[model samples]
Target: MRMALFSLVATVMALGASPAIAQEREQVKLVFEHALPNVEGKRMDAVLVSYPPGSKSLPHRHAASAFIYAYVLSGAIRSQVGNDPTQVYHAGEGFYETPGAHHRISENASDTEPASLLAVFVVDSKDGALTIPDKDATPK
Candidate 1:
């Protein structure tokens, strides 16, 4: 009876540890790259964003930030900002986000292959910060 109880406790502890290890592994996958200041007044950070086919970013805003340059390296992306309709960008094309644009939405195209993009954020380091979505865009 005591051995049985200990076995149950050990199984519970192992199950709990699995989720914590999974979360840590997910946190490790995010990486970013930065560039030197150029003629532009903003600092640049580049990130390789990957989305599983048909995945999307939640509607997010950067009200205090100025510009973002998204360059497609592989696969396709559709982007929507503010009240505008979603727009598609193929491999090799680039899209720019304006200052005070307020919202950005992005998604992958296919369901079989992953989409990849190089996102260059030009930010006013003194005041720049990302604003993630707080509410759902589509009405339920």
Candidate 2:
């Protein structure tokens, strides 16, 4: 995770990347709440992801050993992980993502509504590149 932080800092330091970063900052809000070492020598990380109306995420994948559980907190979220059918989840609903599964779709279900979800990841403590964006994956 330190490497991910450093990479983000380095990206912001690059003048050419700052503009893109600013735009991303305006689109999503990610709150890293905690990180704890699990008994099995892995790590558990928790984050709250918030999206504004009409917001969607670019295709990405977590680490090879990262398993994720996401629970909707408000509004509605439409998501497709791996080869699963795209589905809409409302508040109090949830879904799970297996390790390395592609996050194919993640967006607010309504164009006029916002959405939020709590995501918890169980992964190796040493995994630094937690999220890997798929450059070739086009947005739908």
Candidate 3:
């Protein structure tokens, strides 16, 4: 039937579009997670965030109870927390974010080179998600 054929075409087109959307965002992978034996009800989570040349993440926040430390692993990363001025961090440099801080900017500093960072989070064990993108945020 024509209806079934049209539905199949639409589905195929949608599937093809998904990868382009995914390619625009940075990649995040959990590298480690463990309960903090010395800190009651706290857990530590470490994630490696890879940014392809010129890629960036949307405006987002971490768990409300999370305190984060981010260290540049390779290349340079541009970052801004809360209302602070944007700063570019090179490999070996790092920064921290207080609990509930708004991460307004995060991107690769160079268009020709890739970048990466290790983000270590200290958060309550009860927190469900590590990163929460803002509802109204869109990729640039």
Candidate 4:
């Protein structure tokens, strides 16, 4: 009887310890408006990204050869690309991300203010989606 109870407890523990267990998922919501194929079979994807007060996006990268252009639409955002210095951008300002560059930091400039940006990506039509999160990143 005791052995059976131990086996049940072990089973429960194993089930609960699975890496795929449903926990809250971390995500970045990019509001893309349109995508169109252009010359040389490259496509353009236009997106609007919002960072709420105190919110941040994890370090990530784009497709193998995707170029990104980001324009601030409202509030202010702090970002760093690859090994460059971090900068804060306000409304109407813009930045660019080179293909294969590491997006090191992306967050609101202020904890009290929300920020948003329009991101446009130019990539090969068959390159699939634009962004890919860096799974090996360390927490900020």
Candidate 5:
């Protein structure tokens, strides 16, 4: 009888541990981080983004939201902010977006390598959709 009880306890423990293991695997792979200011007595949503090399996003902006900060991880990326010259960011480097500024253009600098980024956006809620303001603009 004692042996059967011990086996049941062991099985229960194994089942309980399975979910913890799966949760660990779901951890965010952060590449960038930023937060916006309070508007209308509310804080905007923070933004985070991750990408591999050779990845490029369409020209876009966050309406009623703004980028608080941007960070690069793992590899290098290039960003063009408005008419400013394009800048290259290596691992562990980043920049901030001005309020209402056009969402900058981003692209992987290395053709065969991978890169990542984390961007924090200040929106109405902690979990809000990121608005892409201008999708038609060409990448410079």
Candidate 6:
């Protein structure tokens, strides 16, 4: 009986930890990309970020040459860029991040409802990844 009780406690602890692990991850999909004919050596890319309830992305920065505009598509998102205070943006609201800005916060504002955003980036044609994780930084 004691062994069974210990097993039950362990199971409970494992279940409790699952949400935190799940919250540390988000889904990202590249929706569009195109090279600009008028703008020399520049390209435009659009990515969709989806956050499940309680989920968040790790701290990160964009390509040094990228300027980003983010629009909330559904639900609400909480975000903070560089040294700015955190802000919550609802559906139809949007914000921009200048080149080389650090994205300190990106997450769903609601614990029960999922959220999503579309990120439009104008970057140098040679730039690689759109987002780069910060060294020594973790999801909040």
lDDT (tens digit, per residue) of candidate 5 on 1-140: 34633443344334331112211011123222233243453453333343444566666666454545666645777888777888999877878787567656776676566555555545444534455547566544
Give Cα distance to truth, residue 69, candidate 5, Å: 0.2
Greater-TM-score candidate between 2 and 6: 6
For model 2, state the Cα shift of residue 23 in Å. Answer: 7.7
lDDT of 1 by residue, 24-105 (tens): 0011111342434553555655555666665666666763675777666667878887788888888778887887785566
- Give me the candidate number with maximum lDDT: 3
lDDT of 1: 0.57
What's model 5's lDDT at 12?
Answer: 34
Please, what is the TM-score per model?
0.64, 0.73, 0.83, 0.73, 0.60, 0.82
Q: Which whole-number lDDT from 0 to 100 does residue 16 have in model 2?
A: 27
Q: List runs of model 2 lying over 4 Å from the truth.
A: 1-38, 137-140
User: For model 2, how does the per-residue alpha-carbon lDDT over 69-128 read when each residue is reduced to its tens digit?
Assistant: 887777898999988999999987889999879998887786676666767687887788
Model 5 Cα shift for residue 71 (angstroms): 1.1
lDDT of 6 at 140: 54
> Tens-digit lDDT track for model 4 on 49-136?
6666666777899988789888776678899999999999997789999899999888878666566666777787788767777989
Please list the C-alpha lDDT of all candidates, in the order they appear: 0.57, 0.68, 0.80, 0.68, 0.53, 0.80
- What residue runs in model 6 are displaced by over 4 Å at the alpha carbon? 1-23
lDDT of 6 by residue, 12-99 (tens): 3343312323454778877668898889999988777778888889999999999998877777999999999999999778999999
In angstroms, what RMSD does candidate 6 have relative to the true structure?
A: 14.9
Error of 4 at 73 (Å): 0.4
RMSD of each: 15.3, 9.0, 13.8, 17.0, 14.0, 14.9
